[model samples]
Target: MSMENAIFLQKNVGFCNALKRICIEGFEYSTLYKRIEKMIADEEKKEEKNEKLLVDLWECNLLLSYQLDSKMLSICVPCLLKFALKKEEDEETPKEVEMALLSLSNIKFYRAEKELYLNEIKEIIRNHQEHHNLTRLAYQSAWQFLMNRSLVYRDLKGIVMNELHFAREVGKELEEFAKCVDWKKEKEEEMGKETKEKLVLMRWFHVLFIFFGLCNLWNEEFIGLVGGIAWVLRAAKENHKKISEKYIYLLGNAAKRRDVKVEGLLKIGVVDSVLEEIQQSTLNEGVTFQSCHFFLKISERLKEKTDNDELEEGNRKATKMEIFEKLEEEGYDDTITSYHEFLHLLKVNKIDFDAISLDISEYFVNV
Candidate 1:
């Protein structure tokens, strides 16, 4: 049916009621599928096109796909990806591309369909990696694709962390995310007012890196994140505590790896930021423990380097001493002591263990 007719039917009570009755009487969705196929074939002709039809068809597909599971969506995948990857033909992005990506993200895919189209989906994301209009939707689509598969395949988790180059992506996103925050701005202004898209991207980074840490995928390259991670942690600490804690837990997981150097993390300002988090008036035991766990891991790595022949003797001692002195100056000594005391309290039943809700270690092993 033409979109005009569809709109008319939607607006007319009698026509809508009649259509509903027919649908209830087991009208085959194949009719809609045939109409969609014809539209796509016509779209492929590359003649003058009805932009409204393209957008409406995609939006209609998305809405209907949600309300009723339809295999016809699989047929639309290639056309959707093509439209989503279309070059900018005008000043504004073609509305169909965004609609295509949004539709792709919402469609439920079986494992077989994902395997069939996964590489194409990944290519679509890479093609638009820098596109202002499409980048977020591209990743959102890919994220949804992998997320659905990861539920059953398990190994796709490693694919997202290892093969996806999320570290590089995070670097780019953080560079953009930094522009949204102004240190000179008042604390209240900076607290929770970050753009929703950037905030969502931050959470994505947290999850991606958590997998990165758990999978032991942090190479020297990824270990070099300087201010970005710490900025994300501190920026989210006040109003977005859940993500802040996730980042802390991610840092703990990363620190647990022997290859992740303490100095790099120190350069990232995580040490100071974590210490600041520990000293927050609203202390969270889980965050404190994870913070201490990070310190413990770094201290152990430093101690090992100090005791072993990994570094030249004098330099090793100096570096370890310098870091330790800095930690002491930051009151890390008191924080560690407090963390130990808190653990003791939990052990002795003085502090309720139930209050410590986030079990970060599980994320490490499960992934």
Candidate 2:
């Protein structure tokens, strides 16, 4: 058989094999996982194949009797996205991928307490350590955690069950790789030692997490919110930092394309002020306009605290009728839309709004 045909048949065979092993009569994680990977790779191999592959993958997702390892596809999706971003020539697609990954950036599950998903594949690693067999079950567990909201495993305690039935199959090969390394030579090799130390230092924080996590490790669920937030924030911050002037211009252009708010802001004499504020904020020493959203979230509170005296008229709660009538007379569309877009862009861009020049975007735009 041709290699291509062989691969196709292999996928079907693997899927059927997986199906037979599933607790559910026809649940098959391997088949779905391979199918998804094949579809993506096939789409990459030939442009003509893109639509067909998308349809195939969608159908595979739908027809699968259960999610099975499809949940693993959630984690796998970002990996594919990363590869796509690197390989694809299209500009528009990366932004869509970015948004999709951001939305799926979270995986929350209840273990003993709760587990907030991070980039660490610790579960996989831990599985390898306990079970000699890295069977489909382990993969399914990881997959379920990623895709299924972990409802099945919810409220479970993670008492590292004794030696897994098949730990030798997976970890054995990995262990062989470790043995291949010459520890004496590796230690004597300055560059190798330095690199190892660097990696250790880099991952020190994760070590801290596992250490501290021991307290609630046996809890019904595990929520790694702090770790997850740190991972996400770091990723967003890194990606935003990679933005060039051209990229920002594109962003601003996109904002301009969202024209309803900009035009309305101008009509209300706030457009120039808001833009100027954003510009000044962006130019502030070591400041990013992305930070603007952070300030925006609490801007009203800050205004109340620090700018209270600025309101010489004194503070008084206006009746709904008064507030609405005033807003209507001034046209709330422009002000509301402009501010929302402004702050949203700021947050999306990961700017430190708190550190930027205050309200500069809102300043001259209003004039």
Candidate 3:
């Protein structure tokens, strides 16, 4: 057979194979891939005819084969839908219309995921305006790949949700980054807020790396860090005790109790309990407490000691039991494990924490 005829046959075969996969072997995705691969090999074995045609055929087949496994339910979805939609418009069959609708749904799902990604992009730029370019490209590339590859799958709900969640998560990080950089705008001092913020983010990234890095994402290293954040949170709570009481008051409760003063801090309410003993101090007046939702921690103060400010030279202890109980109450243990994993979050963005709550509230209320 002449090269032209052979090439035409191969193209027809490739198209037929793809069509069969979609129409007949709908459930047999594995078969579709195997068939495509085998056909490509057969086409490659034939004698060369038109170099350009061969390349085009090879590329088209390769693209199809590559797409067989590549899932692009979010990015390439729209294009796939457009192709199907146009076909439905031309052929005008009920089956074609149904397929077009199904493809439309697939595209919509991916578009939702892409929307999530776009939201994340905006957040990255808004937060990390300084280093925004770097992350921006990363996000763009991911989205572009999503668009370029046509790998729409039947099960894409999870993919879209994950993309959205990832965007939300990454946005917080980038916003923290932006805020951290903005803090140094006026200081003109060494180790400006930018540097410290970078350190904080890097530290969190380290935790992410450790979590994602190590074979065991669930390592003890994370717990320690979470413990440390808990400790800081504890201190931050104490610092903002007075103001927290004010907010607590706003919650409109019947619990107005008292406790012994530590470091000249006049305390109110019960100790080692969910009821916060408000200590009169400056920090409290500005920031809202993280414990507003009940600050969950695994550590317990093993005999609270009086430190003028910080919890130094104090015997505070944490065990898996205490941590687990507190986290269980808050329902975070199910989502996360290990102190390091938790602490790594704080290591990333020092904001959206108690300190930031204070600053943001203060910014709006006082500043």
Query: Per-candidate TM vs. native?
Result: 0.61, 0.23, 0.21
Model 1, residue 218: displacement in angstroms?
Answer: 3.7
Tens digit of per-residue lDDT, candidate 3, span 249-325: 32221111112112111111222323333222233433333332222221222234446635443322233345456
Q: Each candidate's root-mean-square deviation in Å?
A: 9.4, 19.8, 20.6
Candidate with more favorable, higher TM-score: 2 or 3 = 2
Model 2 residue 343 distance off true place after TM-score fit, in angstroms: 9.5
For candidate 1, the TM-score is 0.61
Write candidate 2's Cα lDDT for 1-367 as tens digits. Answer: 8645654564444344332322233444467456665666666578465543353343333234344343545434444333323333465544333322222222232232223342333444354455433332323233223333324442221322122212222223323423443444545665333332222222222222232322232111112222222222222222222212222222232222211122222233332222333333234322234323322322332233324554432321222234335344544435544666776798899998566665443422222
- Highest-lDDT candidate: 1
Q: Candidate 3, which ten residues in sequence have the lowest lDDT sum?
A: 257-266
Q: Please, what is the whole-model Cα lDDT of each candidate in the order they appear? A: 0.56, 0.34, 0.33
**Candidate 1 lDDT over residue span 184-207, tens digit each:** 353456554544344454436534
- Between candidates 1 and 3, the one scoring higher on lDDT is 1
> Which candidate should be chosen as best, given TM-score against the real structure?
1
Alpha carbon lDDT at 160, candidate 2: 22
